[model samples]
Target: MAERPVTDRGEVGGASAAHASRGDAARRLWARPAIAVAAIYIAARLVTTVFVAVGAAISNSRTGGAETIGSLLMRWDGQWYWVVGVEGYPSELPLDAAGNVTQNAWAFLPVYPAITRAVSFLFAGQYPIAAIAVAVVAGYGASLALYHLLRERIDRSAALWAVAFFAAGPLAALFQMGYAESLFLLWLHLALLVLVRRRFGWLYLLIPLMGYTRPGILAFALLLALYGICRWFRRRVDPLPAVQIVHIVLLGLLAAAVGFSWPLIAGVVTGDPSAYMETELSWRRGWTGDHGGFVPFEGFIQASAIWFRVWGMPEAWGYVALGILVVALIALLVFEPHVRRLGVEIRLWSAIYLIYLLLVFFPQSSIFRLLMPLSPLYGALALPRSRAWRIGVLAVGLLGQWWWIDQMLVQGTTFWQIP
Candidate 1:
């Protein structure tokens, strides 16, 4: 046999060695704590899907509807979002016999729908599946953001626990569904991460779109304002750099505009500046009256009143529980050392959003779902030194998610459980 050329053999051996080294490096990267956390998160979601699907199957058995795994993931508000994705928002809000803007597509924000529509175009106009896919993808991004954000403040193991806890939270089922929560969370966590990392300049881009994604732009803007003021004070900027101040002011204005974009469009189309408010309040018009003013503890009062009447409990008990719950929330925000231990970003987000929730939200069975955005905060509670404690928290979260799916999604139609 002809002797192989020495140069050719050497080159071939060197190439094989380099390929093996690269493969080894890749394996090392895959074994990193962050990657492991992501794997756990994904595994938890797969388990959550199974639980929700089984619950839906049982629900179909009892209720006798053609509910499938896919349909089960796209119930209630999912359907509304799909409508906006397939058929753009109605130019004229649907009006009731009394001329009040009845509940319509306007109640659902447009960003998620707009995204779904864009994706649907790629999929030959199959929107429902597209909508679910968007939610699922956004949710995973949100989880990674949360993990990365937590890692900035806590040890890797604890941060992993926090992400896992979030994935197993009571409303985790919604993360994989066709709803806006996942997308909203992706932006919200990302914004917090940027804030924690002291990248204020990026807010010019993030805040505006964040505003468009949900109705809580003012809360985030206020947080930014507070941060900017603190930064100025820390630096003792006696005259305040004109450029820095102007940038902060512009960020606020941009946030306001983007956050209120849909409402502004609605107002212009309907020739009613308050059209968005009117549409939002239409759902509560029956009992909430004309004005959409914030009332402290009003949601709890509304919920307590409902429970008192429906469950035949003493009205006093509802008030007592409400008081306890409110106090607990306040303590968590104001006094809990664990809260202070959180990154300033998460701490501020929790305190501000909880205030917004208590003031504006009318509590009901659906209140749990509404509070889903705050799931990131609970990750702190999941940070226990004891392995058993960590496992216990995760178990409770998993069970809560299953129960939510069972009661709210499956048995909800006949019962009073809200989706």
Candidate 2:
């Protein structure tokens, strides 16, 4: 058109330069994997924070009590952790009128509370603040570790998507809670990362950390055993060295020892040979009504019957459903193409950990939280390249997060609502 003014041309040039600078900054931010993962983690945490705040607000309004976010974070099992941190495990177990062991600190491991106690000193000994801080920081570390772990087996885009799914999943609220799950997950993800990289030496340190942090080190031990067998079978192609063999054997033994050490420590301290086992069984009694001694693979079976009866179904149906679930899981691990792509080590770890849970864990409201360790499976779900599919799953996760927070944290007045 008309002749453009020189001043207008200069203004348009300046605007274009600014826009280009902003675009370059955006590209640079996404280029660093760590920074990008951190951004996703932080965004997820913010959404979880909103959920927690809403839960607390709703809880307080209903109860007419002072239910702040910190207090809500420290609810349920969080209180047990606080007890462990403040009072330490009792030398003599608490007993009911029937002389059965009641729920006590021995049911929880020491590392999480120990670290929380140390961190609390920085905040004038506020356990909730310390606990949440530890959980949030550990969760951030776990997200980074998970991304790196996935990157070992997948493309960068898939790895990042996996991390996003993990961070924003239904149990995302755990990442900011006063519970031990997030810290344990950080150790677990790091252990898995080293395992995938074939850096067996690092497991020397990680195994002990995992053993102390949670009750799943036995599963890691089993993973090492299976991994060793796999390596031996493939030695011709993979070139399994003698040093790696030693590392695998010793690590497996170390994990087993540490896995059983907690029970021994509890036994020695409380002067009861089955102190830890009894303490765990104490929780199961609430549902099963004073069960017998601990037996492998019994809890799930017992819980299934109890749950089925409660659901107005025949108890036999629970066994049938449980069998079907076991078969479906096995089929997925053995045949699912996406899961196979996650590599053998991940599959081994998942299988072993699920076995561990089926062996000891009583199915209850807490089962969802216990399943957090299997989160690497999110990689499989992230493998599909459809953006709409990914976004749909993410939306479901966010909705699930809200529902879990509302039921388990906000309207947690009933026994079944426990988180």
Tell me how candidate 1 scores on lDDT. 0.77
Top-lDDT structure, candidate number: 2
Per-residue lDDT of model 2, residues 1-419, tens digit only: 35567778889999999999999999999988889999999999999988889888888788898888887778899999999999998999999998989988998999999999999999999989999999999999999999999888888888888888899999999988889999999999999999999888888998898899888999999999999999999999999999999999999999999999999999999999999999999888888786589889889888887789889988777688788999999999999999999999899999988999999888888888899999999999999999998898888989999998998888877767788
lDDT of 1 at 110: 78
lDDT of 2 at 176: 86
- Write out the backbone clash pairs for model 1: 211-259
Q: How does each model score on TM-score?
A: 0.85, 0.96
* CA-only RMSD, every prediction: 5.5, 1.8
Q: Candidate 1, residues 1-419: lDDT per residue as tens digits?
A: 35668778889999999999999998787668657756877898899879977987797788787787788788888888888778877777788776777778877777888998899887788888888888878888888888888878777778778888887778888877888888988888888888777666888777766776667887777776776676677666444567777776777677666766777888887787777877776765555555454346664566568768888888888788767987888787767776667865677778777777766666666778878778667667866689999889889988898889888887777424667
Range of the 10 consecutive residues with the lowest summed lDDT in candidate 1? 286-295
Q: After superposition, how far is residue 77 of candidate 1 from its true place, in Å?
A: 0.5
Off by over 4 Å in 2: 1-11
**lDDT computed for candidate 2:** 0.91
Candidate 1 residue 34 Cα shift, in angstroms, is 6.0
Q: After superposition, how far is residue 13 of candidate 2 from its true place, in Å?
A: 3.7
Q: What TM value does model 2 have?
A: 0.96
